[model samples]
Every structure is written in C-alpha cells, then in structure tokens.
Target: MTSSDRSPILPASAAAPRSDSEVERLHDLILSSLDDDQADEVVSIPLAGKSTIADYLVIATGRSTRHVASMANKLAQKIKSETGQLVRIEGLATADWVLIDAGDVIVHLFRAEVRSFYNLERMWGFGDNTDSTN
Candidate 1:
C-alpha cells in the first residue's frame, strides 16, 4: 500500500487488524527490537515481473542513533534464532541510516532527515509512493 493510503489506524474500539499477520509480525518485531517510536511506513514493493527477491520490500524507521543500532542488533539476533537466517546489517556506524538485508525483504531504519536526503525508496524506483509518513 502507498503512504497516502492512510496510516493503518488502530481503532480504540476494535480487536486489532489481523489481516496481514506475517507482514505485521516482521514489522512489529523489528520495531520492538529498535524500540521504534513510530513506524513511518511499511510498504510492499512488487517487482513481480522484474526481480526475484520474494516480491517485496518493507521500509521502516527507528527513533534515534542508539535505537537504530539496538534495533539492528536485536533484529539480527531474532532472525538468526527464529528463522535460522543470518541477516547482514549495515550503516550501523552512522546510525543515521541503518539497513537490514533479509534477502526477500530489506528493512530500513533511519533518522528523519537522513531518510529524506537519501530517499532510498524513491531511488530504488518506487518514486513518490514510497511509504513513509515521516
């Protein structure tokens, strides 16, 4: 879904959205690991006809430098322990933009300005619909 589609509002009166559990699972897990204050965007990029990276890319964010590193480390550990997958993390030294490469799904955690300046989603060809409320 696009960023303009509206943030997935969690109703104060509902049972919560269970519609996309797998996506949320990964999203929330990563957020928790990073202690995310809020998720700017969680999007799915369909390169169905163009590539072979499991059909999607999930973009997210963390609150700060420490948070980014903390989240990256936690996510790497989680991936290893839960899925037996070894995720390679990068840009930890900068912490302004940290990336977690999980093969089919790549996750991005960034400080707000850094996110805008680099704009990886757009550069990656998603353009304006790049999911991010920030």
Candidate 2:
C-alpha cells in the first residue's frame, strides 16, 4: 500500500495537513541519522489537546540506544537549520527515547524495543483523513 492508502493515525477534531516534502525531509533525516529495525512504522500523532508545546507529534524509532540519540540529534539539527525552528530534546542521555519539540511539531525518537513497548500509534487513532503522499 502507498501513503495514499494509509490514514494519518490521528483523531477527527485535531487533524491538519502538512507538506509532503517536509514529511519526506523528516523521514530522510531520521533514516539517515539513525539505524533501526523498523523506521517506516513511524507515526506522527496530532496533539492539539495533548500538548501545549506543539501542534503535532512525530514518532520514529532507532535500532538501538545509541542510534536513538544520533537520529534525534540529526533530526533536531535538520529542523533547526532548515526551518529555524526552536527545539527542545528530552531523554537523549540514555537513548531509550528522545523527544524533539518544535512548536508546530514534536518528534519522538526511540529505540526499537522501547518503541514497541510503548505502542504510541494507538494513542492517536485516525479519524477520516487518509495519509496521502501528495
């Protein structure tokens, strides 16, 4: 299935469209920055009510503890340099999880095992909007 076939994995009242290029940039940055068992399983959850810090959430995983930190660093830098967005990262030391918070978007970088344990996508169930690559 393509991105057009997959839904956004968010709630109805709190959904919005974001650029496909931006998403691709983010996906590339994350993949290039980290090594992971599975990266495409990544999900970005809209947190309109869940957060006051950001409007949307992006969650991806790295293969190991070290990869998580590296991916977070590269992704954070990419966002900052490209968009001039301010970011705050958490849980980088252990690399179990690293959270990059950009005002409009929040990215969660996690170790694959840890990510599987958390199962974050379920928290942001999709409403009606389909995930389109366009």
Candidate 3:
C-alpha cells in the first residue's frame, strides 16, 4: 500500500509531537536498549520523510516467544522510566510479534520466522541511514 493508503499500526499519541532532536534521542534510546537485550538482526529504518505514523521504524528479532515478550516488556519499561513517555504495546500475548509505539519511534520485536514472514525491512525500502546491530 502507498504511504497514504497505509494505516498506522498503532494509534498515535494525542500528546504534542516531539522535536527532531527529541525524536533522535528516543530512537537512540531504543537502539541501545535492544542492543543491551541481545536482540538479533536488529535493523532501524528511517521513516521521517516517508510516513507520518512514526519518525523511525525499528525491527529486531528474538530467539523465541519468551525472548520477544521479555524484550517488549523491558523496552516499554525503559522508555517510560527514561523518557517519561508511556508507550503503547500490542501482540504481547502471542509474543510471535510485538509492536511498541514510543511516540516518534515504532519498534517491532519478533521471532526470526515471524520477522522473515513479514519482511518489514524490504517493505519499507530500507537503506538510507538504516543501522543494524547483529
């Protein structure tokens, strides 16, 4: 679907939008947290000029459902504690895939199989400024 045709995966926060630097800080915070959690094949896609849903799209894989869920929970906690921003989380019950909407940054944590099935990186045309921690 086109950017306009695509709907947001998570509802946008009603709070004021974050400044560019603030968004960058939040994005960095997420990357660091995922790295510390030992997420595999972590990829970051910049969506600032491409989508209005979020400034950045972060994709990461975990070994299993338990690992995905744990990373989601910990990331949510860290964002809240560090940024004082309450992020919205989804799909934690199944843990095959988890989505975290952290204002300017949207994070997806998934098992390897689930991640490959979706292939968000390719869908987003990932390249410019994208970073991977593997």
Candidate 4:
C-alpha cells in the first residue's frame, strides 16, 4: 500500500494537538538523531494536510541490518529521553525496514536495498524541496 494509504500499525496517541514549534522540535530531534547515527538519504516529507497520521514523514537508509536496527533503537531512546515521548517501533527483528512512530513524526529506517525497493521517497512524491539530510 502507498505510505499515505497504509493505516498506522499502532493507534495514534490521544492527545491535544501540538503547537507548530512543538512539532518542529520533535521533527528536528528525530532528524538529528538519525544523522548522528549515520542514517543516509534522509528525506522529510511534510504531511501537514496530506495526511493526519503525522506532521512529517521521515525516510532514511542504513548500510545494513545491524545499522538499521541500531539507528532505530538509538532514535527511539533519544526521542524518549529528550522529549519524554514514547515511540512505537516495528520490523526490528529482521531490521530490513524499521518504522518509528514518534507522535508528530513518523520515521522509516531501511537497509539500502530495502529502501530502493520500497522507494518511499518516490511513493510520497519527494523532491528537492523535501530533502533535509545533513
């Protein structure tokens, strides 16, 4: 299914809408965590009106299964410790593709081949304006 059409594996947290700065802070935290972990090809897709699941969709790649798992684990811990927001993670067993649901930001971590196969960037119509990789 297309990323936009797929239902969140876990139900969204029932909380009041966050302010713009709050969401931006969370988004920035996620991106930085991934970057620090050496995530590659990171793309951030704004979902302000395109979807209700999250304010932003982050797609990234890791060199291998271990790398993907490590990134996902580190990201989850970082988000929780920094923002006190618990994130739900999936697909860590094989680590071919791991999904991190961080409230307003949804992260997808994949191995190089898996990332190319899913091509979430293309699925989400990512372009030059959407890339924020550092």
**Best-fitting candidate, scored by lDDT:** 3
- What ranking of all candidate models by TM-score puts the best one first? 3, 4, 1, 2
Q: How many clashing residue pairs are found in candidate 3?
A: 0
- Tens digits of lDDT, candidate 2, 92-111: 88989887755456677777
Sorted on lDDT, best first, the list reads: 3, 4, 2, 1
lDDT string, candidate 4, 1-134, tens digits: 78999865543344457899989998899888888888888889898888788889999989999999999999888888987777888999999999988878889999999888988877775443676675
TM-score of 3: 0.86
What are the TM-scores, per candidate, against the unseen true structure? 0.61, 0.60, 0.86, 0.85
Candidate 4: where are CA atoms >4 Å away?
A: 1-13, 126-129
Clashes of each: 0, 2, 0, 0
Task: Write candidate 3's Cα lDDT for 35-56 as tens digits.
Answer: 9999999988888789888888
lDDT of 1 by residue, 20-132 (tens): 45545655565455444445554445443556443345566666788767767777888667655567778999888887776545677787788778766776654445443
| Pairs that clash in candidate 3 | none
The true-versus-predicted C-alpha distance at residue 31 of model 4, in Å, is 0.8
Give candidate 1's total backbone clashes: 0
TM-score of candidate 2 on Cα atoms, chains taken together? 0.60
Q: Which segments of model 2 are wrong by more than 4 Å? A: 1-40, 47-53, 126-134
- The C-alpha RMSD in Å for every predicted model, in order, reads 14.0, 13.0, 7.5, 7.4
Q: Itemize residue pairs with steric clashes in candidate 1.
A: none
What is the C-alpha RMSD, rounded to one decimal, of candidate 4? 7.4
